[model samples]
Target chain A: MPNLRVHNLTVSLDGFAAGPRQRLEHPLGEGFEGLHEWMFAAMRDRADGKTGIDVEYVERSEENIGATIMGRNMFGPQRGPWQDESWKGWWGDNPPYHNDVFVHTHHLRPSLAMEGGTTFHFTDEPIETVLGRAYEAAAGKDVRIGGGPATIQQYLRAGLIDELHLAIVPELLGRGERLFDNLGDGIDGYRVAELVGSPAVTHARLVRR
Target chain B: MPNLRVHNLTVSLDGFAAGPRQRLEHPLGEGFEGLHEWMFAAMRDRADGKTGIDVEYVERSEENIGATIMGRNMFGPQRGPWQDESWKGWWGDNPPYHNDVFVHTHHLRPSLAMEGGTTFHFTDEPIETVLGRAYEAAAGKDVRIGGGPATIQQYLRAGLIDELHLAIVPELLGRGERLFDNLGDGIDGYRVAELVGSPAVTHARLVRR
Candidate 1:
């Protein structure tokens, strides 16, 4: 089964996912940059830089991605009628999402063909429809729910997810949108399947019952 | 001068702000509990004890936050049809947004009030109009545009911001939302006024031209 998973999200000790008043030029928010150092170092240059992090974690975490679900805002920081579609997907000629991709939006625009294997499907269909599309696109591989928080919350509430992997960076975003403000109390059963603690941050995997 | 600043926001190198498929129960989306080692460590030691993150960052970031703006999805994953008027703003007894919050929605709803200083003002208003209202409600303090992604991009494109701070955590969502995905051109002339390479991430100031 291509499990529905929410993986690799970041948050502050104070429980913020992103800061308040996020702007296009700066998406997170001021002073909130401290929330994400762990990822940059891991991707850019691991301290070891070689035989770093357990192979299983890296494979199941980083290189394991199959298809992506990008919310409209994640596509760009624009509002009301895109500016001439001049905005290609955020990544350059080769976007980070190389497999099939689905964009969630009410705007019925044509699919965008990017330079690489990435093509964006704009859907007015229900989220379940999108999830199914992405899953089929994944072809028995796992489907990653690329979130803006709200997107993830919707799926989580629908009980559509299976696993959640996190790279626990050490930091705090005092304020902004929180990943778990109104959450909890509803999630009844989950078992911690894996845990990795490093100097920069910890990594853990949570699987639903 | 109106400073185009990126304040209090954080990002991982892989550029996934929040985890994928966020929900009310697991708001941070799967394993996000790993992201807040510092905060959790501090708060965890003693259930109801105070943390060292400072009252200013905590109170100002969450308490004094005058107003907020979020994408429609950010407000609730549900779309179309009034499921229940009971879905007051996402936060409960004390939502992070304690003042007036203008939600951007094509589908409109009446203004909502919560326990704390939070109010949900559904606006079909333009992004600028929402910003103006939010700024006014903030009364020269600061207004936070909580991210769904597109909400923040609109402000940046309009050049209506002052400061932006980013916390770069280490992790690869490989997919999900990219905070800077569709930004047009370089914000140009912006300089780093402050930078923190410690505390697990790099916190930097982005000042306008």
Candidate 2:
């Protein structure tokens, strides 16, 4: 069976996946500027990027992923009904994801075909239904859950996620949308499979038990 | 000036310092049984204990501490006025803390001197005042902030702690008393000075910057 995986989800030491008040200017919200520095520093193409554990994990995120699912918040800064349809998304022209991407949203939109093989499907369907569609689109490949914290929390609470990889950044966001809160018994099924650290971040891989 | 430091404060990957519904049988609270296994495995006296990063941190928690301060919750499970003074503490006879220990409480009780150098002084004094007394008790040695999470949060909010060391255990308690919640701007003054990981746990040291 193909695994439903979430990889390289960066969170602060305080457990915040992203800082408060995410906007166009500050896509990841405030106080989260340096949160993804470790991943960015380990980019495969970058000349100055460090090659080690961080890079290896970054590479794994793209492996065997045929389809991606994300919350509407992660797609753009706009909320509620779309003010303008002109907003193609944060990524310009050809996005990195060259596969089918499902966007979880209350407001429905027509299927959007982008420059690359990427096609954005907007759906207001329940988590299970959306996941089923994503799995079908994956066609035997693994499904990847792209997150804005809330999206991942939904999957986590439902116990639909098979593997969760977290990069714990050593910074305190103090106040923000916490990734681990309101989990209740949703986290009971998971256990830590691996824990390693670089100078910049600690990587914890949790697998469903 | 003697620095106020916190060490070996273990917290779950979800950021809970202790699990919920703390009681006599459950000292660290429910769902937290194996949270401290990493430190326990690195005990200096244990024949089978492993020595390395985990052990080094455990040893650091005991270094240069002339006095220790903790919240009432950390001292005992009993709440409100002490129904019975018979409960010296969770530790029997000679406690590990061989120094003057201050317990922050709203319901003050007479000081109970235990075996070894451990002496529990219960006081309803303000955090700053208690810290002042603890500093004086230390003479010139550094003071240690032994926490139950709430106590540590208070000192962190006041910016009184000079150094903070956290052992991030790889477990999901789901629900518990979080160490980082309600910190607000209190966490702004600190920065991650060191971060390392063992197979069992990840250690993060935050210093006031």
Candidate 3:
């Protein structure tokens, strides 16, 4: 069976997946620019990046992902009702994801076809329904859960995630959207399968037990 | 000045220092037994443990400490007025801390000197005042902050802690006392000095900037 994997989900030492008060100006919220420094550094040194574990994990997040599911917050900085449909997302015409992308939101929007193969379908349906659509769109390939914390938490709480790869950045956001809150019994079904560290961050992979 | 350092403070992937509903039977709190597995494993293989990073960190926590300061919770499982002072602490007779130990509490009690050089002094003084006493007792050696999450949070909020070494365990304690909660801007003063991982856990050293 194809896996429902969450990868390269960076969180602070305090467990904040994203800094608080995410806005149009600061998409990841304030004091979180440094959170993805490891990934940026790895991408910068692309030639020698493969030699480093940090880069390897960053690259691994994109592998074998046929479809992606993300929250509307991740889709754009827009909140509540959409101001306009003009916002084409943070990524330009050709987003990194070249497959069908499902955006979880309360406000419905028509399907958007972007440059390349990426298409955005907004839905307010239950997580299971969206996941089913994502899997169908994936066509036997693994489904990637692109997160903004809330979206990932939804999947995690539902125990739908097959694997979770977290890059724990050694920084304290103090106040932010925490990745591992209110998990209840949903977390009991998983165990840490792999743990490794690079100079920049510690990578922990949790698999469903 | 004697530096205030925190060592071997193990937290779950969700950043919980201790699980919820701590009591005598569940010292580290419920579902938190696995949090300290790395430390226990490292200690079990004492002869050859020095080669591993986990063991090295475990040993490092014990070195260069003159006095220890902990909250009431770390000292005993008793709550509110001590209940006759029959409890000397979890560690009987010759306790692990063989030095002047200060226990921060609301209810005052007479100082109790135990086996080995360990002496427990209960004080209702402020954090700064207690820290001053701890520093004086240290006699120029570093003072270790023995935590129960709340204790560490107090020290952290005041920026009194000089160094914090956290063992990031790869597990989830759904509900518990979070170490990094309500820190406000207190977390900004610290930066990750070193990060290393073993098979069991990842150790992160944060030093005041």
Q: Which residue runs does candidate 1 get wrong by more than 4 Å?
A: A46-49, A54-58, A182-186, B1-209
lDDT by residue for model 3 over B22-94, one digit each (tens)?
8989998999987787888888777663568877887888888999999999988888986787789899999
Best candidate, DockQ-wise?
2
Q: Which stretches of candidate 3 lie over 4 Å from their true place?
A: A46-49, B47-49
Error of 2 at A142 (Å): 0.9
Query: Candidate 3's residue-wise lDDT over A2-34, tens digit each?
Result: 999999899988788988789988899888887
Sort candidate 1 into its docking category.
incorrect
Q: Which tens-of-lDDT digit does each residue in A76-99 have in candidate 1?
A: 777567657777766777877778
Q: Provide DockQ values for all models, in the order shown.
A: 0.03, 0.79, 0.73
Displacement of the residue B29 alpha carbon in candidate 3, Å: 0.6
| Model 2 chain A lDDT-worst window of ten | A44-53
lDDT value, residue A146 of candidate 2: 88
TM-score of chain A of each: 0.86, 0.96, 0.97
Task: Identify the runs in model 2 with alpha carbons over 4 angstroms from their true place.
Answer: A44-50, B45-50
Query: Could you give candidate 1's per-residue lDDT for residues B1-209 as a string of tens digits?
Result: 11223334655443456666777764555444465443334335345564443222323344345567777767876667767777765556677666787889888888887767788888888877888887787776667777665666667656665665555454433344556544453343244444444434444445565
